[model samples]
Target: MLLLSLFVQPATKTQAATDLGLTVDAAILIDASTGKILYEQNGYESLGVASMSKMITEYILLDAIKAGDISWDQKYQVTDYTYAISQKRALSNVPLREDGSYTIRELYEAMAIYSANAATVAIAETIAGSEKAFLELMGKKVESLGITDYTFVNSTGLNNKDLQGYHPEGTAEDGENMMSAASIALIAYHLLKEHPDVLDTAKVTEKTFREGTSDAIVMKNWNFMLPGLIYEYEGVDGLKTGTTDFAGHSFTGTAVRNDQRLIAVVMKAVDANGEGSYKARFDATKKLFDYGFTQFSEQEVLPAGFVVEGNESIDVIKGKADTVNIATAEAISLMTTKDDVAKFTPTLFLDEEALEAGVEKGTVVGKIVLEHAEGKDYGFIEGGDLTVDVVTTENVERAGGISLFFAGVGSFFKNLWGGVTDFVGGIF
Candidate 1:
């Protein structure tokens, strides 16, 4: 334990800059294994997400490739709008030739590794034929992922004003796409779980667009926390970095050590001087990662087939048996500290219809809602199952007709006798 604490210590040596707490607009730390948040401050407040928006574009592109809707080698045609954006040295871009052709693989590498703005637009064009249409697709995608706190105005995350007059219509001219820090963390968490291979490209420190060619350009990854870069932290690989006049410096960072992976987000980080810079964001992320690894560890919080004492079973209606046993559908574990192990509470819920009907073993009759006081459980982006499912442990059959008839007769006579006894007692 002491060794792990030593190894996972914050990489940033300066305390004066970060001791006043995280100097960011918002921040979050999450355990990727369980969609549970470890810490957050203003995480739910919507703010400019900047280039971190490209993570969605990257996800759709990767999904398209995986589904065979697009090929890595498929050539992408350059448009004048894209051509103009690519040539703008002020914005991050790899020069593209309008007269030339580039493959999906080439653009993807540039977009992922270099945060090339035009390259992202090229992918959007290929997938949905226009940036507005691509925004619709992005809308549908985020909806399916259960993301609600977001407003994406453009594909490249560039301020719409930077797109000149060529910007997609129906969006504000000066608006920047916005999302909460928690929302970005959700995307990063799912990205690692669903398409882990993104790390293959995101980890690249430097890549060339076209080696020894006229359009040749050298691109360096904007994420500086990967291994050899300045502000590098151990196990840091992905996910994206964002900066703009409005968004300041934002980064979604993830790391793995001791088999536990954590995702951290720092939105608009600044130093003690209140100056937003690359180092500030990395330092902010380092604090989160350090706090996550050192203070918390993953352990089994709830086991499978668990039952609430004294409320373990429900009454069975019109079945051979009057009651049935039930237990949790599965086991659950969470990333937490030893002190928090006692804080978890699981509540059960039973389905009334299932209880009324003859049910088979393994039938899902209810669920356990696990709650804790430390943080709100985000569960997963899609949905959390059962929290844990409560299922019947044994099959129950319908009672025979003869048994029903005898039970009905017994009930009738019992009521009659009770009424007669009540009348005699009233007279006395």
Candidate 2:
């Protein structure tokens, strides 16, 4: 039989960013693998998250495609309202021709790479019956991501008041679509981590819809920073860029450098005179990416089956074996600065002590605790208390009457003790 040895190291903190800027209105940088925030500024601060809303739209649309709710090859009819909205300068039009049918894949490209409002609304109406229902779905997806500071009132981020069918260009005084810088970063992280394939769309600098169709419209990429923003930055892919008179400017940009990928968000930032400046977004992203790549490194904190020294096995009574293997469900890793990486480790704890024998397999043992050098708790890792029956490989016949007689005598004494206790209780 092979034995599985469990070794658990105490949790410790690895080195991390010492100074992430605090002056930015809202900014956040997180480790994609572990969701650890390396640098943050006004992380929870809420502001108008312009085209960044499309990131959520991208996620929902892809989910529907995969779930068989919609198919890429299926062509959709473009409504008159969808056409009118596409014509507005304030909106990012996909240049779609009315009645010019397009596939789900084509629409996705327009929405993801170009932040096309028309493409977004078309996809929204198809999946959720109406744009409002789609927005509700977007909000639900946001909540599922563990984000608490955000709300979605429309699929296109056109502001709530524009839904009235008037003020076609959208309104500044409308109920604003809101989100935090950290939340936007989280959305980016989700795209890369959960749906890496999204890069296939985001990375594209250009694409055309309905090359064969007579009324096909051409779509241009909205994010200008992708082509030639930074010399060292290559494989810099595409992500949506958003700006409204009231929402200011917000951008969620992701780039790949060698084997490393980073996602960053800038909210409430504008140009020289304060008009949704993509340049500012580009510059801000450079600061975050440089800081992350140069100073931050990913490190494994715990390995699977990590054992707690004192709680390796629990004592069980009347069972084949006295104890069972207690181990973690999976390994944990985190991103930290170089200095703190050395002290990182996994700490385990048993919520309760071992049970007296006779415990069955798969019983709840206790929870394990993992911590960092900063004393921040990572999360609880749990273990199971199971009974392993002890059996001999080879069978042996009873060597005898004498051994049998001794076993009988022991049983007799146990019964006698029980009887005596019963008699004493009756007398009392």
Candidate 3:
């Protein structure tokens, strides 16, 4: 019986979000380097972002600095507009004096650690001429990131201006500044990916602004997950935290273990009495990091040149040689549980068409995937993915399409003629 072969492309792994025992309104855990979703709950659920909005603002500011548009040491004079916004009194103010000034670096630290509303506005004004125009830049950044749910109203999230009778229309407060745990995590990841040095300031547990400049203001990170916590978790780095009567408490955090870095975000978590919101986010994030690091280990399955199928040589058509040796494409590794190691199955991905008469040596033809037991004890145990490439013993010139077509037609006619001759011979 003749066997028909079909060539199919390699399959991409589908990520599944797992539920953790998190009471936070929304949360997600992700692998920083790979953008792999390890676990998520209400990951796409949007909520008021509060000062977490500053992350996007900080990102834009960093980009401008990196592009030479502004330098950290460059002084930004505090104009009346910046000073007036700082005096809102409803927001977290770093208290910029109308006559005093600060450098880009100072504003960066204030926005990142203290979550100072005034510092955010001053930075925005210095960079984009007005906070409104700066927010327009923020929207563009969100759009480029593929974040669909978030909107920006002002440099600092002090609610709409109408709350203070400044602008009644602004009082209606657009929900333009909403975001989900997933989007926050992605933004944090990109920020770290591009400029890892930002973490240096964010991780600071305590610092003070220019001493005499603003009544000797002491600044401390509101994020409880930073180092110096009672938990003493290793490799935990500071990110950001936010809380408003409307937005609740939100936090983004990063942790590293054994060379693996993970980012976790929690949003809209509230205390039973509507306080201690930051503590809730801290607890949830610590739980996620602990759970991820404790359970899974990376396993290597197929090493390069490992024999997949053996004892029989596959045919190579119209080559300098009749056959060739085929090997696994690359080494394969998977993150899995201890039990999965014993029962893992590796599937070979190959295109049989490439094994035809004229084939190129060392062309990637397929992939190897290890499937693990699904659910509970072994849930999400992927045996790790692998690739397979063909190593031909001899090179063959590729046949032209026109020549191959004519040759195929001629071969069909010749076979027909031979069948007729064989029938005639039998009759005779």
Candidate 4:
């Protein structure tokens, strides 16, 4: 990997949530297209995630299905523990008979829509045979995703105490899954990007489980910010909500209006009086959404064919030409304040092998990523620099032996002079 840098002359702008007065312990808003953090506060501090952790569980299940290890029509039988947990009417659940076998589709609908704990446990058991084992799978998946800060103890995000001594081992009896706002946002980011179909069920505002049957129950989504719901936010679609004594009220929300989409998360939200309520979480999320939509807009940071100043081409050692022209393969747009649109510098990272002599005209040689000139880059949740491919704009053929001999002589003198100067300096 070749490192490159650029200079830009401007200071960009950012509007902090502190100025907006967000009422959450932690929060983050990101652009869905580029994964750029638009706003954040206390985003790295770990806190209870409640059922928002279900997004990770949803990811695993979807992956298993995609891998052919499981199927949507697969049947699941509730275990004694999951059955008992489901029987607690105080918890979010639809009645599940111990003798009943349900399809994975229906159970997933329960978990994603109503935040049903029992249905989640059943899905966990079906996929991994037990919640404890499923926890291991979740761990491996998290590690593979490069997440380093998290505490996941169960497939369901319920406190271990809620598991009735049947919780997964190696966790405190009273513990619930916890993750930093940035970390959980990363989880949701992966889930939405990897399995966007999760939105289909997540966007369902209300549905009846087992319609026309005695056990039928109406499942209204706990995400009140969704369209046609109580709070009724337009352009809102699929996402999750969570609530518990430990988690207070948290939400991961996504919405798109006029072709721009934003994902926002708020944890432990409180009202003006510092009291937690479902409304408080939604209200805080609204602030994030409003700030993202109003304070920021997408701007093309670098256009295709962008070339680094004074480094427009790669030096070719034995090519027909002295160098090959290379530039950004595509345009990159970032979500930032309109005033900050022209304040980004693109840093190029070149691939020496790809840029070598005789390389094809369209060969990809590097990548270009943008940073705010005034040092205001929050970066993406995936922990990777948002970049666009850089490719050769034209090719250079291998030079003839005679031309190579001449080039080699020039290179030798250049190196000899540099070495002589360094030797004299060192002696002096």
lDDT of each: 0.84, 0.65, 0.68, 0.85
State the displacement of the C-alpha of residue 245, model 3, in Å, after optimal TM-score superposition. 1.8
Give all TM-scores, in the order shown.
Answer: 0.87, 0.74, 0.77, 0.89
Runs in model 2 lying further than 4 Å from the true structure: 1-17, 160-173, 212-218, 225-232, 270-276, 303-313, 319-331, 342-347, 355-364, 375-428
Candidate 4 per-residue lDDT over residues 1-428, each given as its tens digit: 87876754343435442466888889998888767888888899999999998998899999999999999999988788878998887789987998999999999999999999999989999988888889888888888888878898888888889888888878899989998888877777788888989899999999999899999999999999888778878778969998889998999999988888889999999999999998999898888898889888878777888888877888776788878888888888778877777767777778773344686877887888776676666767666666898888887888888988988899999999999999999999
Q: Whose TM-score is greatest here?
A: 4
User: Order the candidates by TM-score, highest first — what do you get?
Assistant: 4, 1, 3, 2
lDDT of 1 by residue, 1-428 (tens): 00101122222211112232899999988888877777777787999999999999999998998999999999989998889999997799998987778999999999999999999999999999999899998888887778887888899889999997777888888988999988888888888888999999999999888988877899999999998998889999888999999999999999999899999999999999999999999999999999999988977778988877876677788788888888987888878789777656666666663375477889887677665533334344334532787798898888888987887798899999999999999999
Model 1 TM-score is 0.87
**Tens digit of per-residue lDDT, candidate 2, span 20-72:** 44234677776665566666666677888867888888888878877888999
Please give the lDDT score at residue 205 for candidate 1. 92
Query: Which residue window of length 10 is worst by lDDT in model 3?
Result: 375-384
**Native-vs-model 3 lDDT?**
0.68
Residue 193 lDDT in model 1? 86
Across 1-428, the per-residue lDDT of candidate 3 in tens digits comes to: 11222223333433343456677788877777656566777777788777888888888988998999989998989876667666754566677877987888888887887888778877887888877678778878877777777756776665664224321224245443678877888888888898788788888887887767535677877766677855446888767777776677777888888888888888876565645456677777788888777765566655766555541235556444456666665665555446556554555545563356566666545545554333222222122333344344345665667767877798899999999999999999
User: Candidate 4's C-alpha lDDT?
Assistant: 0.85
